[model samples]
Target: MSINYLVLVAYLVVTFLVCGIPFGKIIARARGVDIQKVGSGNIGTTNVAREIGKGAAALTLLLDAGKGALATGLALWFFPAFITGGVSVAPHGDAAGLEGLVTLAAICGHIFSPFLHFHGGKGIAVGVGTLLGFAWPVGLMELAIFLVIAVASKRVSAGSVTVAAILGPVFALIYGPNLGLDLLLELAGLVVVWAHRSNIKKLINGQEKEFSFHKRGDKPEPDDDTIGESK
Candidate 1:
């Protein structure tokens, strides 16, 4: 398969820009709140939920996830993959690798967004959305693992890292022997785990705060343990 370098680069750049949008920060700004100065100072869903209201957080999540899904869907549409009766997928060599790279670009856009001067969110929602757009079964798998761990431990980062690290095997199982594409997708997951490094450390040290919703009245929860913690 001959590669279209020009089109590939253009697609990646577009995906990066689109997925890089900091909806969390934008929503906060609309509500007269600076998400960057609140909670963990991250322009992600967690920070929005913790600092702003649930409505704003939901909007941010929806937008962030939408961009990622759109990017991934475009990739699969452009670099069509080989599916066996809509059950199993086989690699299309160059096209498969390109699809993985495109999906990776989507997550990278959120983690190191050019719009935010290379600073951005932890990439959880976008990563899931990207995978969901790529292979919904795999996406659901990751989402299930994330929800289980998150709910069990009350720490979102734990769920994020677990899903990110496990994608290698997940791809290996579902994508067959497409080592190159599998590895490429694993790179996408690695970028997500990298974004959650601080949270990883906090978790290891038992200092990570549990995911909690802020009051709608804009008042802090009296028992909010995250009030003093910077995370």
Candidate 2:
């Protein structure tokens, strides 16, 4: 095989391995807890914050986001030579089609982690990181939107879903149309939304739980009737 193809394969392997490391599990182990058995049975930052300490949750978010950023950065370094000459460039932009593919792969690895029995986090943190890889403006705007909605609704799921729902259009408007990036973001957003399907049902039934920053031990468990209502 050609060197470019070899590099591409190597990139995919490394990105998947790095992104699928399951930082939540590592943090939970350090705290003597199994994150997968905790709130929402998710390994995402929100669940970590609910079950473990906020410090652990913050660390997990940063690590997960870092995975995406690192993967995309590597792709940008190695994949530029692979971009076809005929590919359309966004205004004043270089070839980033491969970056989109790398971002998608990183997000997929986080969401469907091979190390976690193919079940993983909701991908919000990594998605933000991937956008950051694309451009600081895109990442900052999405992060701002997420913060606003999350604070207003008091639900991380709500903020996550809302930002994901609008990511494609917003990216298109801000960065100009790059069909590869647009399609990748659309797929990534849908996957994120699907990951929160249970949360959506809870919201529709007026039963979704608001986020709490308190440590898990600080709060008593909700009764069975209220269980499974929080993420």
Candidate 3:
């Protein structure tokens, strides 16, 4: 096997380990709260802000997103992109496809964390991190989309779903000609949506929690329904 294979394997393992660190749960526990037992039982930024303080929540968001960004960054640092003259760039071959897989690995590590016994966050913050890993242009676009929808709906889950659902295609458009990578990103997006299935159902049924923009806690008492996005 090529040295690239070994490097890829190493990147995957490291990414999984780092991204699996649940910053929200750890931060909440420091404040005498089991994040998983709160309104949504989710260890994402949203739940942290609700149960603890926005400060803790901010830390969670930064760390969660950081782990992912770190993982993806390391991989790309070792791997090269397929550059195009005009503007397009990224994989169109084996290394490129592997890069996509490595990016996916980052998200999977966060979602199916080994430390949490294969349970983890819904992939919003980490997803943002990976997009940024791919390229700032792609990452910024995703951030804008999440913010627009989230602000308009007053629900983080809404923004998360919309951005995740479209991640693969939009990413493909920007850096495609690599079908394998495109499909992997699409699947990653699907995984994000699946994680948010409950929240989506709640949104359709008028049960999802909307932000009160208050200090802590919100209206409807914030059911165990899920409240997180944009780490």
lDDT of 2 by residue, 51-161 (tens): 787899899999999888888765665565665665433322554556666767887888888898777888899989977865768889999999999999999989999
lDDT for predicted candidate 1 compared with the true structure? 0.78
Give the per-residue lDDT digits (tens) of candidate 3, residues 1-231: 666567667778888888889888898889777777667777788777777777887899899888877776766655553222332224445545665676678788888888887878989999898878756677889999999999999999999999999987787777665677778877888888988888888899998888642254443134353534312
lDDT of each: 0.78, 0.77, 0.76
Per residue, candidate 1 scores C-alpha lDDT tens digits across 93-158 of 444676677778988888887887888888889888877887788889888999999999998889
Scanning candidate 2 in windows of ten residues, the lowest lDDT window is: 222-231
Off by over 4 Å in 1: 1-3, 80-94, 219-231
Clashing pairs in model 1, backbone N/Cα/C closer than 3 A:
none
Ranking by lDDT: 1, 2, 3
- Off-target runs (Cα >4 Å) in candidate 2 are 81-95, 216-231
TM for candidate 1 is: 0.87
Clashing pairs in 3: none
User: Could you tell me every candidate's TM-score relative to the true structure?
Assistant: 0.87, 0.87, 0.85
RMSD of each: 4.8, 3.4, 4.6
